[model samples]
Target: MAGNSDPLSPRAKLAVTAGKAVAAASRAAGRGSGSVIGGRVALKLDPDLLARLAQNLDCVLVSATNGKTTTTRLIAEALRAAGPVVSNALGANMPAGITSALAGGSESKFGVIEVDEKYLAGVARDTDPKCIALLNLSRDQLDRAAETRMLAENWREGLAGSKAVIVANADDPLVVWAASSSPNVIWVAAGQMWKDDAWSCPSCGGVMQRPGDDWFCGECGFRRPTPSWALSGDHVLDPHGSAWPIHLQLPGRANKANAASSAAVAAVFGVPPQVALERMYQVQAVAGRYDVVQFEGRDLRLLLAKNPAGWLETFSLIDPPPTPVILSVNARGADGTDTSWLWDVDYTRLTGHPICVVGDRKLDLAVRLEVANQQFQVCENLDQAVQLCPPGRIEVIANYTAFQDLRRRVGN
Candidate 1:
């Protein structure tokens, strides 16, 4: 009984270490811990963390290849409007990280977490969430995740239960097929949310046909419907090209999906659709994700692009390219370690403007830019890249490592 302590003690321990471990895990990621192989050692060292989550009344877990952080933040904010809500806002989606956030927080009506796909099943088993949101599956960190199909298989097996409601991205064939058999499930679609590419039938492996601007699986005919609460318009409407006339707060099309997905889950919980949208737009962008920082005399937009799909979406949102772009790329072992994914990104959009590429893979980025037919200025350092660019409002597209570097230099 000495170590058994209280039933909730494990949860409390997880909460206490959630913030600290994220900080440490982030720092020590590539150093060891075997993060490169999708095998996480952090959760193993902390056994009671999962048990602690099982004690919560209502818990919501968000998992996907993209938009997890932004969408999760939006969900937390929506819940906060009604009352206090606790979350792991620092982009730590792993089991221990989620447990830490929950255990650390005081009592509340609901628990919202943005979980990582690699750890989703484990998190779900331990947390016993009232609901779980599977955003979308995509090819990401091939070195660690292996492939999207493999991860999907793991998700299907792990999510077999009736304790939670499954909210999924209808636009994604993989997610649609994965959740089709789930009894307690609700599906939401972006419905022309942006230029999406993940449309196909997971069941038949045929090209998922697009009914309208949106997509569906033709072979299986398992087309997910758009959530009744999705935002639709003649156009996304960007009055201000450079500075954002309407001020989305969260830049790009991907953020739109994040916001919409967040809204969908909140709505399912009885939060009004209008209320969810209002809270989503009103919420400030999560720090370092797609935050716009005002530096000395210049304004800098910080957009994080950790994978091919993410980078493509970020590129789409740039509108008229920056007079000069500051691009930062890094493939630290902690962040998938392998930079080969860059090869999959269609960097050709940069051909219209000159880019100042920075980060650990500066040279490779430059090579990519050139191959994409983009004109760029290669800088050995991120700070220097930011420096060489014109002052007033610089657009910075950075990955995980580059984001860290930009934060250090910009005092973020």
Candidate 2:
């Protein structure tokens, strides 16, 4: 295996060594937070480590309320046609994680980073990315991120001075408003399945008009921008009106939209549309979004849904009726302490389905399901929950920490 022996100044070299040692110790101690600590130590030692490592590389920074990790994986996979790409694939999306990824993969010629929504501007300013892909913005980590509109404002101010090309989602009014000021922008009509966050105009606080998939602000005169790249069913339409079929191993309309956004970013890097789509099909699982794993003698398909918007999209992918589903929730730091978002999800859609609630927040989920009149049993233990599931393939949808815990328990 290659070691992290990159050429750097004395202090940075020392910092890298210290960070790697810390990460190694953390892993040895069986702590899953090694990446987080390692990155923090590296940043503490050399504040400019991320920028220094990303200096001459063609970098693509992806940020959004959701789909950032999967989208980053898609973009990184497609960029293989160009050269070696370094990315933070471990789901650690902050500056520290990006630093660790770039510092560790020092030999790579390109960088594809999954940045947190709040840190996008700082990372972009530091790395001077070649392109920025702005996916949909929505309510996520309310305790930490506060509000979606505030994040949009931060992004708008941050990217205003950037010279990088912006690939933004036109279906989302917040994204449209954020990227509208960029000198070079490519609008993509990636479908937004959740519209609760974008109900009002970010510019003037007017109730947005939504007729089918098209949306416009009646008061501010803001509307969805015409997309240069769009997804029509399973086909991707190019800038010249030519359509190409996309086949992905990942499921959900959201993943298809992610593929479209990735293809647009790949185009900015001079990659052919066909090549980008081909590369995307090779990705079966991202981090742990969609993966079939064997747990307690049952084949469990893992789906991670962090918030209400995420749960809404994930619930759509579940097979209705007869198919048994496991829903898990946790109130850990990574999963967000407040579980109030549970009320926002439309659990009524699963009224007739066989549902099993599991995890620390299983009671909270059960309460929501009961209020929606959905019949479900509480199973705090995932192993027991799998055993109780109906005879057939079982699907497990879990929030942040719940998903990670299950993944670790199942040895995935």
Candidate 3:
């Protein structure tokens, strides 16, 4: 948020006003939250609007291919215990969305900014965050962006001069390699669900050696760092090995991992570990990720899984057995233009379940499901998909844009 003691320059103020007006107009027109365009206009007027707004902020930037939005939201909610907090609660991690988020919370004391992996360096350079959380890196937007190791190298090079204490996940090889270059780092043993992307070492390009929870490149002797905070079973363990069981409304192991990372970041901001965990429990959902919406007597729960890594985590959270599953996918600008990522995910996990596919790329998904021997029926829309199922609990898992489309269709 912009500081009260240090007000914005006149031109900057005009840009903020214009951005807010555009955002409000966007909301009224039902065009969508105007954070992107409004902030884009604001940046055009004041190219340094983000840097200027974030000048006095105690920012913590979170970047990961998956769980970034949820982790950012969890950290922001916990930081509220300290004081007014500003964050991109709407899952807008880019420059324009971030600008709108910071502008909205003018008097916020702390900023929890969710950043895209591609823009992490620039955002860190602009915000000068007090702490930076680098979650696991994996295959995402394969058609549009670099792989995990290359992206990790960019993180290593771009953040070489940063003074922020890096809160990195030691369980991920890519994250460890990137954060190892930093001057100050607080490692957390956050579990990694997917390992296909990190098979080759980032430092030496050798086959990674995995002995239980530890990973190292035998060629270069590059290994995982001992974490200050670790997740032991269902409990979160601190540096002293004292564990606290986390009770949260949000489901999935990914979210639990996110909670541990958020708690660690909150502690850096002066919020006690227990206090941060307790505050995080009060949050029932993050930008409709775990929302349960009722549609025609059946409870339709929403889940977002954009990439294979995300799908693996999300699949675990889905109800077992006869509980029907709705799989949605798209190749929109947000969900990557290439549909090749569909093959990376093993659809055989849904073998026994009644599967229904719906999305712009539903046919692509159907073809994949066919080869996996997972029988599925394609539906044109969510209503039709749910109509085909008996009234009970329905799990709707969708990619980026498809998830938003489902929310709008359900009036979420």
Instruction: Report, for every candidate in turn, its global Cα lDDT versus the true structure.
Output: 0.67, 0.88, 0.90
Q: What is the C-alpha RMSD of each candidate to the true structure, in Å?
A: 6.2, 2.7, 1.4
Tell me the tens digit of each residue's lDDT in model 2 across 1-412: 1223446889888888888889889989998758778988998999988777888578899999989999999999999988898999877889887887787877787789999998999999988988999998988776776598988999999999999999999999999999997999999999888899999999999999999989999987999999999989998898999897888999989998999999999998889889999989989998877998877667889999998888888888876677888899999988788888898899887767788989998988888998999888998588888888756678799998899888988988
TM-score between model 2 and native: 0.96
Candidate 3: tens digits of C-alpha lDDT, residues 97-126:
999999988778899999999999999989
User: Candidate 1, which segments miss by more than 4 Å at Cα?
Assistant: 1-46, 191-200, 214-220, 225-227, 234-248
Q: Please report, as a residue range, the 10-residue window in candidate 2 with the lowest summed lDDT.
A: 1-10
Candidate numbers, best TM-score first, in rank order: 3, 2, 1
Please estimate how well model 1 matches the true structure, expressed as its whole-model Cα lDDT: 0.67
lDDT of 2 at 20: 87
